[model samples]
Target: MTNKAVLYRMVMDDHLCPYGLKSKDLLEREGYEVEDHHLTRRDEVDAFKAEHGVETTPQTFIDGRRIGGYDDLRAYFDKRVQDEDDTSYQPVIAIFSVAALMALSISWAAIGDLLTLRAFEWFVAISMCFLAVQKLQDLESFSTMFLNYDLLARRWVPYGKVYPFGEAAAGILMLSGSLVWLSAPIALFIGTVGAVSVFKAVYVDKRELKCACVGGNSNVPLGFVSLTENLMMMAMGIWMPIRQFVL
Candidate 1:
């Protein structure tokens, strides 16, 4: 006799409980026979809820033992579920990865080569523009969060409000291959301030905080990604001027 698990889920005309499907799949994958129960109508769902005193659908039962919800079932099987509030590098990784690919694609299309110094400059510029877009989406929220650790922003709150605009302007100017005199200095000053702020907040003070690099709602840490963003700006700032004037 196979070990049997029961899954109660909604499969109504307009609704199908995703957790219920997941519960059934998990049980079958774990070598258990699944007895799937669908509450296909409102009254049936209501009765099921009343009988179990549960407020939601997709309740699971294993060998007559109840496992609460999707998260609970995962816990019962010693599996880990990502929490909503957990800090993750996923957002930053996704942004940089896509930006790098875009830079390569654009460089290849424009100049007929993927491997060139100009491509690197485009990569940095595109990255700045992308990050600036995030901040610009919610300037009020971004500035509020940015003031927490940015040295210049903390001293002069107006700077935090202007940071995203400056970033966008520099990036756009660099991308157009014009106005290096203006873009380079702006990038350098902001990048220098940002680098010092991140170093102080994360390394010197040993403080744990979220980075505003991607916006106010970001979960990226106030360390490596933040520092890298600043360093990229600084390198682009110094390189653009030299390339235009000397190289």
Candidate 2:
């Protein structure tokens, strides 16, 4: 037994007190030390926030990594909790987004032909509205992102807060691409963010290997190339700004 141990830091939330007690109990059961930081003062909270740079309450700092609030705490202690979303809804979400993208992206040309402004608008609408699936998950869905990277990509996977959070922000851009006016600006911005995400996933990630995004994409058959294919979509995204939403 090491004399110095890493403590699981549980910062209490008024709504999530059960989480704290559950964490404390689970830690004891697991033989890890637990430290409870029931923060009530703004100064104390600020100090903790400065150490971790997190804005939410009910945060957990485990071995210098912030485990985030309640949902995360539940995911940690209970396998059933985490698997609940993955086994249950990931496929459904994928199906919804896939169908929306395909139905719109395919029939889009029939609307006015690809080169025409109306047809172009339909593509943008498909992509943006289709991203509604993203709102189904938060930064937590890919909690396994880092772990899945190293084993599959064959390199060190970075564990950081920014990547998943960036995905959340990208969700907004996905929605923004629908508008006639804001579409151009938001499309450019979304593509740039996407490029950065790819760089991180490929060069910065372990082995530049692609992770399985969704099983069959409902019926879309998204294979290994699908990951690379999105990069091309990033290329296609450039056309979005071309029309420039002239009113």
Candidate 3:
């Protein structure tokens, strides 16, 4: 016997329900023949909701049993459901993984090697840019989180706001191998301050807190990953000047 499911979702002229699409896709993927229903008009949606006594759209019914929405369907299949407030390293892991892949691709294209010194440099530089972008997404939130442990930001509130911009500028300059004079100092200063701050917060003070490395809203812990970010910045800051002037 073939498995079958039914789904009711919003598909209006102005807006389509994303969860509805996801529900349909999931059912199809799970070998279920879906009877899809679109509630296009507001009144139709309201009427359906009233009839079903449901508070939301994109509801699913499997094997003649109500399976709720996307989350519920996932739960029914024993899949992990994401909670926004949950602490996770997923974001950081994704960023670093992508950055490493990009660095390798660039190195292969430019130097005909996948594992060159240039690739390593680019990996760190790209990672910095990615992290900076995260912080820049919501400066207010980033600054607020940053002030929690950053020594300089605590004393100078504006420093927290300015940090993402500085990190971005330094990363870009380092990646392009341009204006060593400016990039090195910016990286060095921020990296030093960051390393010290993270060390004090996580180690010296033994305070447990979220890392603002990825962003203010990040759930990444304030320890190894955060310290590594600062250390990488410091290494790049020092290496760039020496590589340009010395080697």
lDDT of each: 0.91, 0.46, 0.94
* Candidate 2 deviant stretches above 4 angstroms: 1-124, 131-135, 143-181, 203-233, 245-247
Candidate 1 ranges with C-alpha deviation above 4 Å: 1-4, 10-36, 39-47
Better of 2 and 3 by TM-score: 3
Q: Candidate 3 residues 1-247, lDDT tens each?
A: 7899999999999999999999999989989999999999999999999998999989999878898989999999899998877788888999999999999999999999999999999998899999999999999999999999999999999999999999999999988999999999999999999999999999999998998988888988889889999999999999999999999
Model 2: per-residue Cα lDDT over 58-147, one tens digit each: 676567676676567557656445533233344535644564555455555455333544443444344444443332253344334434
Best by TM-score: 3
| CA error at residue 171 for candidate 3, angstroms | 1.1
Measured against the true structure, the TM-scores of the candidates, in listed sequence, are 0.85, 0.33, 0.91
Cα-based lDDT at residue 116, candidate 1: 79
**For this target, which candidate reaches the highest lDDT against the unseen true structure?**
3
Considering TM-score, where higher is better, how would the candidates rank from best to worst?
A: 3, 1, 2
Q: What is the TM-score (0 to 1) of candidate 3?
A: 0.91
Each model's total of backbone clashes: 0, 0, 0
RMSD of 1: 2.7
